[model samples]
Target: MSYFPAFLKLDNKKILIVGGGYIAYEKLEHLLDFSSNISIIALELSDNMKRVIEEKSLNFEKRGYQKGDIKDFAIVIVAVDDIPLQARIFAESKEYNCLCNSVDSVDYCDFIFPSYIKKGDLTIAVSTSGASPAVAKHLRKYLQELIPSSIGEFLQEMKELRKTLPKGKERMKMLDKKAHDYINTWSSK
Candidate 1:
């Protein structure tokens, strides 16, 4: 499947996670960096997962999946290993018209989570459409090594400069040239 690139605004949004295993913990760790309003519903939670819940003060409900658990959530992440359970959650999430991601199961996912490299506000996400996660991970590793840590600062600088530039085709041309020049200078130094 051809995937479109999009950025989600999850700040203060309610997110639901339907598992507490290692995969669930990994998903929670990633989400914790974005939103604090996360609710985890699972039959049993791992020690590390419980610690994270307590530390983040996240809402944790010790229960099995229910039909309407995903009703009010903006996004639902199903990290459960059971295919049947994942399918059930995916179906329920569709009824609520919310985005759902089933871990390692692209067929059940509304969107696939990419292997990402995050440095400050700069995030580089690499995905291979679930064809090969290892390839995506490898690409992420390469990007991590190639991309400078100062990219976040550079992006901020560009944003600030763009606001002051004239608004027209000229502005677009100037921005493109300036970006190229900045990258060239950055790599040379």
Candidate 2:
């Protein structure tokens, strides 16, 4: 089945991650790019995980995840290797109406993380409906190379134009022309 694509505003929202090993650490790294309001629950943390927590100054509990640990969080990521625990947390997350992702277990996941490229305010997400993550990653990398480095600057210029130009059909036409011209020029580089 195909999943809907949506961008969430995560500012001030609570996010819970259950685990602190290598898999959890990987998820944490990706999450850090989008939000800082994350709390991790784990029995023990890896060195890299500890460093990220300390650097970000995130909320953490140094113990095993409890039955009700997913409370009040907007999103919950279960990265533990134990399948039963992943399933249990995913099931419990539903009680709190939280979106849950059980890392590699698609059966218990409410959503899956997509491979993405972030350039300044621009974000492009690539997904294959949980079919092949490797392909998604490769596509993201290809897109990253294909996109021009000047795109961020171009976006900033567009933002300025949007603010300065008055609301009218003329403004829309001008903006459309500018975007088309910029893309045509950048694609040649």
Candidate 3:
């Protein structure tokens, strides 16, 4: 099924990750930049993972994931290798009306995490509807090379301009024009 792509504002949002293996660590690495309010539950974590939790002072429960452990979080990510456990978590998450994503299991996911390129405030995401992650990664790399480092600074400038501009179609037109002009100039450089 095709799904609409959206960028979620994760600042201050509670996110739960149920696993502590390499997959879970990889997800945590990305999530750390967006949200500080994260909770991790797993029976055993790798030394590196434990160090990260300790250094960051992140909330961690050294136990296996429970059925209702996901009830309080806005987003839940299940990265365990066990398919049955992932499925169970996906099913149970529906009871709490929370968003769930089981790694590599699109059938059990409420949302798929796309391969993305991030530069300061600018972000570009690429996905192939879970058909081919390698293609998504390649596209992300291509975009990374295309988007200039100055784009982040340009985005900041646009944000400041947006605040000063009046709220109406005129403001949107000006913003779009400014952004278009900036990108055109950037591409020429």
Candidate 4:
């Protein structure tokens, strides 16, 4: 099935990760880009994983995941090689009304991570509805090269200008036009 594309605001929300191996570390790296409010449960952590958790001062429990560990988390990511555990966590997460993502297992995922580019306040995401992650990664890399380094500064300028302007349809239109023009000029270069 085709998945919906969305960018969640996870600033203050809690995220639970049930693994501490390579895949878990990769997911943690991605999550760090957005939110630092993350908790990891694992029987054993890789050396790099332990180092990262210590460096970031992230919450971690060095134990196997329990049955009712899905409480209070806004999102849960299962990255273990154990398919049964992944399915179990995904099911448990559903009962708690939490979104779950089982990496490499689309059937057990409520959502999939999109390859993305983040520059200041700018975020661009690419996905193939879980069909081709490689394509998405390539497209993201292409965009990373295509997007000008000045785009972040430009966005900051736009943000400041927006605050100075009155809130109205005219202001919205002006901002829209300004952004479009800026992008058009950038793309032509």
lDDT of 3 by residue, 79-185 (tens): 99899998999999889988999999888999998898888888788999898989999989988887888888888998888898879999999899988887898
Find the candidate with the highest lDDT and give its number. 4
State TM-scores per candidate. Answer: 0.89, 0.96, 0.92, 0.94
Candidate 2 Cα deviation (angstroms), residue 167: 1.6
Q: What shift in Å separates residue 83 of candidate 2 from its native position after superposition?
A: 1.0
Question: What do the candidate models score in CA lDDT, each in turn?
Answer: 0.88, 0.91, 0.89, 0.92
Write candidate 1's Cα lDDT for 1-189 as tens digits.
667878799876789999999999999998876788999999999999999999989999999998999999989999988999999989888789999999988889889888898887788788888888899999999889877777888888888878998799998998899879877875686
Clashes of each: 0, 0, 0, 0
RMSD of each: 1.9, 1.1, 1.7, 1.3
Q: Candidate 3: TM-score?
A: 0.92
The 10 consecutive residues of candidate 3 with the worst lDDT sum are: 180-189
State the lDDT of candidate 2 residue by residue for 86-189, as single tens digits: 88988888899999999899988988899999887889999999999999999999999988988889899899999999999999999999999987886687
Query: Of the pair 3 and 4, which is ahead by lDDT?
Result: 4
Tens-digit lDDT string for candidate 4 (1-189): 777778899987999999999989989999999999999999999888899999999999989999988888999999998999988998888899999999999989999989999998999989999889999999999889988888889999999988899999999999999989988986688
TM-score of structure candidate 4: 0.94
Residue pairs in collision within model 3: none
